[model samples]
Target: MSVDILIIEDEPGLSRMLATTLGAQGYAVSTAMRADEALARVAVDDPALILLDLGLPDGDGLQLLPLLKQRCQAQVLIVSARDQESDKIAALDAGAEDYLTKPFSVAELLARLRVAQRRRQEAAPVTQCYRAGELVVDLDQRQVSLAGEPVKLTPKEYQLLAILAQAGGRVVTHAQLLQAIWGRHHSDDTHYLRIYLRQLRQKLERDASEPRYLLTEPGVGYRLGDGTA
Candidate 1:
């Protein structure tokens, strides 16, 4: 299937330019001029990835990140005019997988989208059984066990755990996890990630406070003790 990309940019010219460029590159493109509109668009058309502009007329794109994650399965990459280092860090910290400042090249945008698409395709299927440390998740069988004893996971909780296990040891960004487990449109729902992570720890961690297997990268993402890059 042609990869679908959503462009949430306020600039009409930029949005049209990007849509034209990506559409010419054989991608299915969708554009939204405001954060609220973007959310509404995501609800209707499930895009594979999103190109987000930080400063929106209706609301800040950063604030909408967690909401997007909870509402739609979208992997968001910030494409905005904001140039401050703090802006970049804040966006990344807020769960954006990548950041691209204004005046970016169309070629570069295409390349980055290619990378994101490839990564998504290359990802191992989130499946029934996953093992990391003493925790094992049998998703298909609806089973979980820690150190050989049966454990329980809510549907969302199990999904969160499965994603971390699939990530191996490499950090799975909050956005990535949100997109994987929740949906691309809901990439902004960090609250869901946090809540589910806590639940997973309670069930799988020897000490939920000082977890070993489900390690958090502070503001970035999560990783399993197993080996994933």
Candidate 2:
């Protein structure tokens, strides 16, 4: 499949330039100047990845992260002028797969895209089961175990857990997980994800109040335990 890339930038020139550059690199490109329009495009035709700018006309890019992730199931790479350390962390915390400051080189953007795509492609389905300390996930049977005991989960909860585990270590956004597990129709149900994540933490965490494996991305999404490559 041709990898479709959505560029969410308000600057017309920049959007065109990015589209042209990325297209030349053999990617299908779509551009949006506003968050609402971007969200609409993503909903109708989910892209494989997104290049998002935080300084939008209608809303903050961070606020739209979940929507983009959930509604479109795209890997978000924040492309913004905001260069604060807090901003980068916030974007990452919000479930963005990566971040790029403005005035970025097209080469760098493409390189990051390659890295993200590689990580996703290399993800092997959990064969029969996976164990991380006390947490045990049986992919085939759709069952979980904690501290040598079985733990029951709702269908959504099980799917969420499975997504995180399969990620290996990389951050999986709210949008990606939502679309993958619940389908595009249920992508906007952020509350459902939060509730189910909480349930999963309660079961797998030694102290669900202070989770170790099911780590929250705050405004973004959740990830598996902190172990990342």
Candidate 3:
């Protein structure tokens, strides 16, 4: 299927390479070298996925992540030269879906793109229920099940899962979850998120330590994944 993709990289050579490659793959491609231009293009194009390079000329991609997220619901995949563990975690926390270190092969990049595309396709708005493998979250009737058995959940637990379900497997930052559930004043209360997420995992996951549905994004927040991968 044809997909709209945005390449937000500052390096001219790298950006051109990406645009050419993606265009050849049947994707509609656009490029931006600065954060401002990226935002403007996003407003006009409404891309489905964004391949972002952290070291933009105007501002870092880390700084632009939240803004991009707020402006459009495009899935962001950070493709950067920064290979530090901390950089990956920071990008995830800033709301990037996946990270790829620089000097990657075409095969590796294509593999990553496949995963992102699968997630985006799965995340498409559910008309009634959301299914991730055996787990089912019935949005229309407010019910949840695992392995075809009913799963009892508190109002808050169900609410949290509902939010994640609606997200369509994308990472939902801690602040976003807190504000949605607890209120804007409580958006920074990471403690609440920790408690609630833990509780939800206990109920939803076969092994809470190795969660699938209630996946943790380390210092960032959480996302719901099929976990088959």
Model 2 C-alpha lDDT per residue in residues 1-229, reported as the tens digit of each score: 3348989999999999999998898889888999899888787667888999999999999999987777766778899999886787678767788888978887898899997776556555547566666777788888888777888888778888888877765667767787888788986778878888877777777677888888876765777774221
Order of all candidates by TM-score, from best down to worst? Answer: 3, 2, 1
Candidate rank order under lDDT:
3, 2, 1
Q: Score every model by TM-score.
A: 0.57, 0.58, 0.77
Best by TM-score: 3
Q: Indicate which candidate wins on lDDT.
A: 3
> RMSD, each candidate, Å?
8.5, 8.0, 3.5
Clashes of 2: 3
Question: Which residue pairs in candidate 2 collide?
Answer: 69-175, 70-175, 94-220
Between the candidate structures 1 and 2, which one is better when assessed by TM-score?
2
In model 3, where do residues sit more than 4 Å from their true spots? 1-3, 39-46, 60-73, 82-96, 227-229
- Where is the poorest 10-residue window by lDDT in model 1? 162-171
